[model samples]
Target: MKEIRVFNNVPVLEDWMIDKQVEKQIRFLKAVHPQLTDIHWNEGRVELRPLKRDPDMKDYLRSYGAWHFNEKDVAELKKFLQQINGKGVDLYYSAFAFDYSMVVYKKDGTKYEKGKVNGENALFTSVLAADFDGITVEEFRREKQRLLDLDIETIDIFTGHGWQSIILLNHRVTDKEILKKFTELMTAKGFKVDSAIVDAARVLRMPYSFNCKALDKKTKYYDPVSPKIFATTDHSWTERRYHVAEVFERLNSLPDVIKQSDALTDIDVKAISTAPLTNTEKKAVKEKAKREIEEVKQIKVETLKAVYSMLDFERLPEAVQKMLAGSQEGLRNKVMMFLIPFLRNTLGLSIQTIKQIMMLWGERCSSKLDTDFVQTEVDRIYGLGFKGKHGHYTEELRKAYGYLEFDKYTKRNKIIIPNGFFEDMSTMSDGAVRIFLAMKLGESLDGVKNFSKADIQKYAQVSERTMERNIKDLLSKGHVCKRRGNRRKGEGHVYYTNPYFNSVAGFTMLENATVKLMLSDLTDGEIKLYCFLSKIVGDSRAECWTSQKYLANKIGKKGHDSISKMTGSLHEKGFITKKTIEKDGVKHSVYNLNY
Candidate 1:
């Protein structure tokens, strides 16, 4: 007898059963992306490379499916699911978001007719993932527990036949080497991690999407009843995203073994370092070494300058100059104490100069000390052998001694123009030149900031059309470069000016007033002359001496007459004061910049 179940006065039959696969897929997508309600979620761009079963190839799939696709916003991604939900195809999404409107090209440098994605266009990777295949559900759970025991957070998934685990990073890792090393470390840890999914553009099965591999007869897990199975989230470790560096350090710290089981020949397990360093780690180490070397060099330079006979007392700090002028009887000894270090450490004065200055100050004191006492005091202080800014008086101590330290008037706002930069700007449009200067002014202590197009327009004071046209020109000329912005903000592209120009050991500083004159008042030819003079002038002197011919060649002009005329114009405009100076019977033009 056939039995029928009745519920709520309605008979439910076996033939009337309904599959809730669509509803399950909707829930799965929501679970993965709970930030769907957040407006910024859509700004993170992604790519969906839909692949259908290849008729000619038994197990392979080709990206020839006809469908409506979009990757601009997170909301758009939901729409994409509807287009391919029922279609007998496999769906894979980019591992990381990308800059908008990124055109992907083929391996041979030809443009793709439709769409292709890879690491070349990735903005950044938030999660480091590993795919372990041919493992049962039980084994997947065991591996999950193993990672938990080690205090590693992960999001584990079951993709029909195998397991995939993801470790979220606190911040994005833009470097590909770091992501690759992560996957390699997983493999080296004796897990059967898939080596091929290391690329930033690598794709994984979309959550809640049908795993079409079950339908392929060539696959080991092909089933008769259910050809397509859902990829489900087995467990989620949502406590926190681990710091990117700490996660890498932790994984590399684990016991590693040479992987002879991987069929991939490209990865040489023996060549890999036992402890791999991310690009960030390598950069930090390099910067630390560079800073230490620079500090030593600076100390040496300051020490060498003490031998010069000319002492510009006005250039010394006001407090130091006053102390050197001598003090009353009550403050003489205290003044001497501070002056010793001020001369030796701050000014890097030679021992002989320090002694001479000390003796001179003692003689000028109201109640003078004995010459022998002054000499002995100087020797005693010098014997302490302080090095590298030791015994330097702090600002608080300076105040207590009735002296103002580190006066604000000594600081200058400087705009650094890399030497030989004029050559790159010669061919740029006037608007591009203005934009470049604005970018220089916009630089912070960290060098450059990620700026949107709107931010740039505000900084450059240009119209939208002007910005669009000249910025494109700047990019084409390689004077500026574009980088991905913070995906959380959905901001426009960030640009870097003069990316290829290498700032050498020498550079020219344009005063704030000089920059205004170059941008607004001075002609382009006059600006060129001014920039060249600014470069050759000694740091201590406002005037520079050069032949007209030398200036002509540097300014990219063929004739000395052009340089002479430009200099005359600059002088007329009160930007410089010109004079003729004779050295070794060679009359050279000397121009003093009026800043």
Candidate 2:
């Protein structure tokens, strides 16, 4: 039934060959949809020759077709598979199921109406898959070992060029967000994962099918001898479905390479700072100096720097920076287009300051700009008023910075915090503020079932006593309400942020203000300042005029100096733009929210 060839004294199979591939495909299908029955066609569909990409056309999936199968149609499925074997087109199957009755396809083998699988039409997914491509065998081995170390069991599919690690969940997951988070956590675990596949409608290479792309002689991936087929060397199929929490807990348990990069030295905390660690005891009197310095350093930069990488504006392209310093013969326009506006809008420099800087930049150029021309350019740019998409100079500077992959803020998913919440936050203690924010964020994400007091402390980055004390404070203040559960039932207090503060409804604060406040590296003091500013600024205004004395009083700070320092810190960190304006013989600071 199959042809064989001899080349260079080696016998090669002309067709894709694998052991028990048909049986394996059946088992995978059954595992994915456990309710498969002979009475009706199964939920999933088989895709034939799906378009990878097209230079001309968009919505390529709509141009493709699929084969629907019944439980008793294994022989027919086999016949179809045989017909397409080595036909130089990929065979794919939706990893998740769709509503069979609603499925539709055109007579010309193209998808019609509701035939394509997507988050809306697709029903549920039983497996979470991560695709890794173009990696070396040794690298793959290392990734496998990393998973082994984490005790994460996956059905590892060797798909021609790379591996696809699939985690078969114990139950079908309807929440796409949870599935999305799984891939994100995998990325944090140092796995080079293709995050695009974490969706309800994703497809994988059929187990019995050949990787037709690899057979193309024109492509760099073409291999003549290797059989580019879906096969697994280890039979590590998970026997039991893993609870979503259990899987998440395992993935989030260990610190990945980035987190562990700065291994804590054996240096005593007492040696770093004399101020006792809130929970731990003092080790030695001599450790006090070291402890204080370390604490100050940690508070100022070290820990927060690692978390909020967006502050590193230096990560902007070296070419862009070099252009600002000195443009070569052909690229003077780039400095005018990109660098000038970057300094004006992003850096928030005054026009005069920008002029002075540009003059210096011109001097450094190979062929220096004429003084009057430089002056005219600066005047024209300033006249345009730092607006993006300004008439002549486009927002190419902003675009250049965007390409740097700055630490992205999480999408709000329409969760809006009321402005009153920020005002209330200004009145609370730092520990209480963190705990309350954590609970609010937790509720927004998963709800009350998952976050306990211990979990709250971990998320809030506060101590046990801090959590207990502040949680009580929150309850007494009516900012948070808690319901206690029976200890005998292994239940704990479930706390909820006040609905007034945490509303998914139609209220709004500064855009992504809550998420940014929760996730940024802003200190408690800085957060207090930010909350106060955000409250004043509200949703409508971009900039607010307020005095430091007023801000200090609102934030419960005794001195305006603290407010000034916080404002300066916030401005330096790109959270806000602070400028002094003298209005009616009195000086006031204009704070513009940037997050």
Candidate 3:
């Protein structure tokens, strides 16, 4: 068995060496206990008793021969150490009360329960000893390497009989729960942790102190195994100490221990039962949350409604309109299947209301929709909710459904047309009327306004063939003039409308409110009738005399009854009044304008 030498009695230190060691010890103590004012040294036993910096501290220091040491005491301490050499006395120092607490093992090597210190908010430095009965030197070396791998800065000390690893923590870890969890983790990671050494009252052997346990009477030094500078925080201080802030940070980052079996571990059932919410209060909170959701939903719905309303459905191609109307049940189902969610989510329309509208639209289609199939699809869609897949009508669908035209319903950068334009074009086809408006509305009223044939076709939703025909008719009737541009340069035909229509005998200037009502609320047929009546009656005349058949021919209606129904609708809307009149034994309906 290897015998351990516990004291360095063979070499007597020179006066300078003894003074240097004493100064170092004092510096260490001062760093750890900066507030201590009373330090007592008696027969190789040092005690650092702290006193309040008051008159009482001065009196106590004088009486007990305790004083804060300075450079003057260094020589005296060196002399004292030389006198005590080989006197069977061992050098010892009182452990200064640090800003931290640590555990120390008793000399008997007995294990005890881990104890707490008073300053829970105090900072700490930890040390692990591999001096147990069976730990080998190789095992200690391996443990040191392991701590290095964990990024823990360690100060290795050869403590005469064994090894000690010191780690300094930078921050305060005041919570006991945190400390317990940290220790548990360290133990799990194969560390030889001294759990009982966590007490604040524990003292540690000072570095460079002489151990008196050697049977050979030779003094063994409690020296640092590693360079002192390497052991300090950031390797910046020249002391046998280290900052293990990184290790503490890693420990803190570990996931909190979760108790799996106890579901009610966190619940304070007694407190909850004592302060339960009233039924009315709970209901109010639920309602408030629901209202907030509904308000957000409403804003989204309004935005979608605006986009849908901007589409000119009436101007779509005939085939596309037929598809939308469900002329083919298969095609209609495919289209409506995609559009239903948009109607529900964007317009906030009820499923029942959407079904009703689809059913009505189907009647106008070439083939009516299947009610059973429609009902089933709507129910299925409502169950799926909105996932953004079918929440919008694509551009392809818009073109196929005859919504590609730019009309009053379409959003525009700007639209400027004379009030008389509509009245003058009342007798034309809807396509022609829209084309004429498109020509005039491109810019502000100016001299010789120009419009390309392609632009007119796009805005009016008319075919090239139809556009040519409309331009020809307008030119022949003296409604507009056309100028051809160079075809090689991709220039198009330029057309200009007459400042005023010659055929319109008089003009009726309508108010902004009236024009808005006509554009947004009135049907095409109603608008045509109102424009015709306004022209014939002029602002001067209140009434006009004409038969339903003649009125039907003027407004392009095929049936006299259709004209009578339009008249009645206009009358009900307060736009016109109707009465019978006779001239030259011929009876006629006289219509009078209300505005």
Candidate 4:
């Protein structure tokens, strides 16, 4: 079985625990959310963060034939088309488990052995269907009626009210891309579709749960088979669909979608959990797993001796001698301590300091393996010097120390070792979030006019896949506002951006970009009007009281002089405020928009 699980996911940066101070805001969010359970009265308003969500799993079931059929009603009816729609759900996590898989169908056409069900039959699922345009109740109601009047046997429509938009997935078709093309073809016939969900054109079955049953008409009994994963599946006996239109058309009762799968799963199974690893423990594990790789064959000892002929410090380069004299660390440090001992006697130095140097160099080991490499280096050090224990050092030491230690052992090397590093994500599948740390750093809206999902990903280092989840997170948590555009580009669709983070003063200058700049559909007239208004406010020394007619003439509208009405509309929008003032003994309304 192809394992597939649908989850309602969200991003981390947008998370916030609501507090008492945000009580009013919580009510506003609840007013818009249809699936909110209840406000945590004692916990304060922070519960709103997870409270705002986009529908995913709830929408999936709405589109499945096995869901919302109400077998109680099915027995009374011959066939039906069920219209299932879901309201937005509270999502603490963007990835909330929706279903499980219980069966596996091998490529070779044999049923998977139930003995290995835990290992071979089960698969963890991650669901991604049609985005916000999935399915709808109003549309399904119309569709079911249409199908019932026809010869259709079965049908399913799933719609999710996620982040205020509907996401629909229809399994009646075998291909999603093809469904999109077909929808477009229908659009040519006066309809536009968001998308289709057929990434894999096959039937899916829910696993573990015995809530579903396929009636075996020939056997005259309910033939129940429960799978582990949640999906649509073809019949075991034939390649045909059960045909749902006949039923929904035959029996016209629509029902509301069921709720959170996470809540049910949490009650029945272990949640997403993993053990963390300590830094030291992790480093040790890495070392133990390391395997040696050789780059070349070793040179014979006789061939090396013939090439060198003699070993003397005077024969080596000046750079080598300088490097050998000053270093301690790495392979070069071990060699230096080896050679310096021989030189100590010849140069008349104390034997005690030389021994101390050798012992000090040995302590530079980062791991037990490094110690072994150091030992080999120490032997090389002995060979490079004169034919005695008191040997000279090599140039390699200076180079190694040059990179490893710069400030003459005078300044203590400050190495910041993390107390621990996380490794639990390996099993969970996210590595420090789905994106990089640098990418997800919160942005200050001081210089931003408008931000896009791509912009969020580039700056926040979040995965593109997670951008949609992040948007709901940012908006629902009140990190941003879901602003509706009245300007030219797009009117009905909502735009989101940080409210508190975005500066109200000179906002256009700060981000150096705005909705007008990013989306091409924004009209030039709206942009011009904004720019003109901004210039007047920016240059004013004090409040200016000017007539609408004068302002209109200044704006170059000679046709009908719409100055008064235009200014009045701006005032009503809260963009500017009107106040009465006497100018040259004449009473006129002056607009104040500083707030």
Candidate 5:
């Protein structure tokens, strides 16, 4: 039977310089023995292997045929099998190993078992059967116990991800109705079991595969990672992808894999389990890895500097700044490789400006970067002399940067606000603009997006003048879009208290003249009053209407006089068409929202 971890690639990272420095090679002994290898690409249906089972004679397949045509996903099925058999495991994405999943065989492949494990081996509809949802806890307990029964005393699950690892509880308990039964059964053993749920794209080195045998009932090493795996933001997505086939391929060389142990009291087994790679050896490997880290750093710095300086930055987004700032040394070098050439190609940025931005990044991005890749990068950026695929390198650089941004923004922070802009947005006092953000923040009592004047003031938390200037500035720049109105013939107002507010498209301000009139003049109280009207009058979404009670309770201190003042001001400004209507034997004024 096999257990597979297919999230991270087994052997992805490669450094030409490091490879040269380490001088390590996969010494193939010329097909030492006849064997079968499997490949798995643990992705969606479009990624699964084989439309059906291969005939048993599939063994007749060979070298020339393999070279001529890739096996029709037969490799994938094999990978699935290898992983289930606990052949090998990888903790990170391996570029070289694309197909990886696991396959396993149970000796007694039957519907029921002697021990009540809530046993059920429901289905294997998938050509490889990687999705183990239908299998019950009873089934897993039987499989697991079967291994234990065969002198497999310890349960060291080569965990990859999902419900498979959640088995410390049970497979089906992931709460998805389909897989819950399995979750309950796997975790019920009350036995010491161990697994490692890979964190996204992280993976251990190839040499570490030998470490799997170290898993024990005491202090099992499940997280097979080095500090370097988390050293940069670049490997965010593929860090945890290790395919079954790749691991099996990597570990196939060794047999009875465990290292010889000396029964001693003073020595720890893990430290010397495998022949210690001599101190000089470890140093050489670390140094090579460290150099690769430096090279990546250099490129990253150049890219960020070139791109940021060329843009009329107003400034860098906040989230990006933090990512760039997280590391203290080698900042520019790190950013340059990851970002520079792509920036130049995409935006036509100047190298001189790149240097200047690199300087800025020195304070945040780590250190100054060497300009070695500049010319080559520039040539690539401009598609100089190459006509076949002009933007291949540029596109790759873009994809890399996008992956970096996903980690910086979605994984770690809310957004990418420019530095110092927070102070500016906070101090904004224009009643309308401030009210607009306040409404947007859902009237945050603790923050700026709140609409009420007091809450706005609390949110601004800066000098009154500063807040007022930004609010007015936003008004003048036409940041606020829709203007609430007092009355209109066709638009009879249903509810009345204050106007509502809406943000218009930032670039489309020149087209909408009505909003300009609404922001022309206003006191603090008047601004809040009008903002309230904007909420009710403008075409706000239906969900927004739910918060009116919260707003009223907060802003009720301001008398209805504020409403009257706003209505009069809106009418005078030609913002609405108002008319008198009779309702339930009473006269009422109906207002409408102007564009």
Candidate 6:
């Protein structure tokens, strides 16, 4: 006889074999039945069952039930097997213990009864198996080779007396009808598929474990064989197993194994345990959406009042305009904080209206504010009290919105350019007007003041080229004089405001610090409007009673609305406040200085 490798009628599983072979089977088992709560194995037999809750494992095991397998139970299992190696114990494991149940119905609409079966239902998955009884080892090997030739990947396990080969699917198959059809197809292919094993409670020999056979009163233990040679093996198999994507690709390649129609049809709601929403639920959802849309539209319409109140909103500097329009959440929130009070106190709008409008505005932001955050902000504003008479506009609010800050210039150094100087400069480029103002507000106490090109460029918010062009225009127009600095040392040119200009008025009687701080954040149009208001208010009084038409004429703007809007922008920036004063049965706005 060819040398048969047997160890004293006992099969010894080496540590390396357990690591390589037995561990792989355990992994595949876990992958197949990941929801398996409990598994049972005995010294001479193996049984796997899902843990029942009430009785518990300790009670069931005491009643001669198999040992339960948990995450940590694998080590205990290996140790038990090692101790019972020569004691005539054989290991078997339950297969197909999935969460889903497959039921077979009889003609009476009741579950079909079977003999010696725990239940008519079975746990079905992607696993497909075929039994080859009364077949020699050589014949079984040839059958496996034939399946390989046909490009069908499978795992073969020797059951001591017979063989059982299984087809590992790309994914788990849970549909009962599909499982039934698959089994029928396998039977048609001349493979011995056990129809009785379709039930939930079924067991198969645990691969890599001993298979004890008793013949003529003599016992012999045979080692189960499980070799890694399959294209569609479970990824939990070896160290370098197939990935889910590869498994899907392999599954797609097998048209006969899984028909496209069957695969697509099986993806219905019944397959995923989800039901379609009822018509009543859908109608409720639609109504909610419609209500939300109407609310947003109403809020947007109301907010237009606050937007229109910023009369010189369009006349604000490009940077200020961008800060208002751009999606900077913090800056936008700060703007809202100042605007809410302005609308309530200055414009006299109600809190409820402001809340709705601000909520919608927050929603329109680039990074939309959450409803809770918007609500919190509205609550904060409410807590501050109405204070409709007292103003909430502050330097902090202006600075928070990226308003430029001006260096404090002393009152003695104030240069009072005539109202006509602004009128004449307004006709030039905005940059030119800004540069002239920058030169006028320098550190010098009188007449000629020294200002670097960098200082003028920064104050004017212009590029180097634009600053140069504006400076040239100012010099050509006799508004200022420029003395070039040392070019080699990278020094800037010095600029001096022309004191002898015909339109030049005496030094401004108002506080220089107030004028500089107010002018720092205003546009050319705003500056012109502020100058007209200053002339009207005079140096002694803080308020000026005037009509929009009068301000419009002074600013050279034809539209009274334009004048009102410019005044609003001035009001918004804390330059001036406008209150309606009725005289001779006619309402006129009295502009007051808030500086």
10 residues in a row with least lDDT, candidate 5: 27-36
Best by lDDT: 1
Tell me the tens digit of each residue's lDDT in model 1 across 1-595: 0111111211111211212433443343333322222333343354556665322333333332111222343234444554454455566656665554567777899865334445566656566778877776456655654565455656565665576787754345666555577677777876677787867667777544456665556777555564544444333323234556556555556666765344222343233222243454355446534432121111222432242122334345555555555454324545666677666565444455566667777766654544644666677677676664435554433543344555421224346676655665445555665676667666622245666787678666778898888777578867678988778998667887754456564566654434644655566567656766767763443467778887777666778898889888888776678888888998888887654
Cα-based TM-score, every candidate:
0.35, 0.35, 0.27, 0.15, 0.22, 0.29
Candidate 2 on 74-123: residue-level lDDT in tens?
A: 65555555544334545566765666457455568766455556555566
| TM-score computed on alpha carbons, candidate 2 | 0.35
Number of backbone-clashing residue pairs for each candidate, in the order shown:
0, 10, 11, 60, 101, 4
Global lDDT for candidate 1?
0.56
For model 3, where is the 10-residue window of minimal lDDT? 227-236
**What would the TM-score be for candidate 4 when compared with the true structure?**
0.15
Which model, 2 or 4, shows the larger lDDT?
A: 2
What does candidate 3's lDDT look like per residue over 376-455, in tens digits?
A: 45676666677552434444344444443322221122233344554445356644554554454444222236777776
Tens-digit per-residue lDDT, 1-595, candidate 6 = 0111223344455776555554665665653433332344311112332222211123322101122356566765555444544334444455443222234666689764321123334334435556665576456655654454343545555555566666653333444444344444454444455554454345555655544443112423222342111111221121111222233333334445423334423234224321233353345346534432221111232343345332223332332333334233224445555556654453333344346556656665544544544555556665586675323434544443344321222124344665545455434555566666666655432333577777777656667897887677678777788788879998767787775755435333333444455456787677667766666655544568777876776556767898788888877776676778778998888777654
Query: What is the lDDT, from 0 to 100, of the residue 527 in candidate 5?
Result: 45
List the lowest-lDDT window of 10 residues for candidate 2. 1-10
Predictions ranked by lDDT, top down?
Answer: 1, 2, 6, 3, 4, 5
What residue pairs clash in candidate 2, if any at all?
A: 170-241, 270-287, 271-287, 271-290, 271-291, 272-290, 272-291, 272-292, 273-291, 273-292
Q: Which scores greater on lDDT, model 2 or model 6?
A: 2
Q: Rank candidates by TM-score, best first.
A: 1, 2, 6, 3, 5, 4
User: Per-residue lDDT for 161 in model 4?
Assistant: 24
Worst 10 residues of 6 by lDDT: 230-239
Model 1 residue 73 CA deviation (Å) reads 5.7
| Model 6 stretches with alpha carbons more than 4 Å out | 1-410, 423-426, 445-448, 465-473, 483-494, 502-507
| Cα-based lDDT at residue 298, candidate 5 | 29
lDDT score of model 5?
0.29
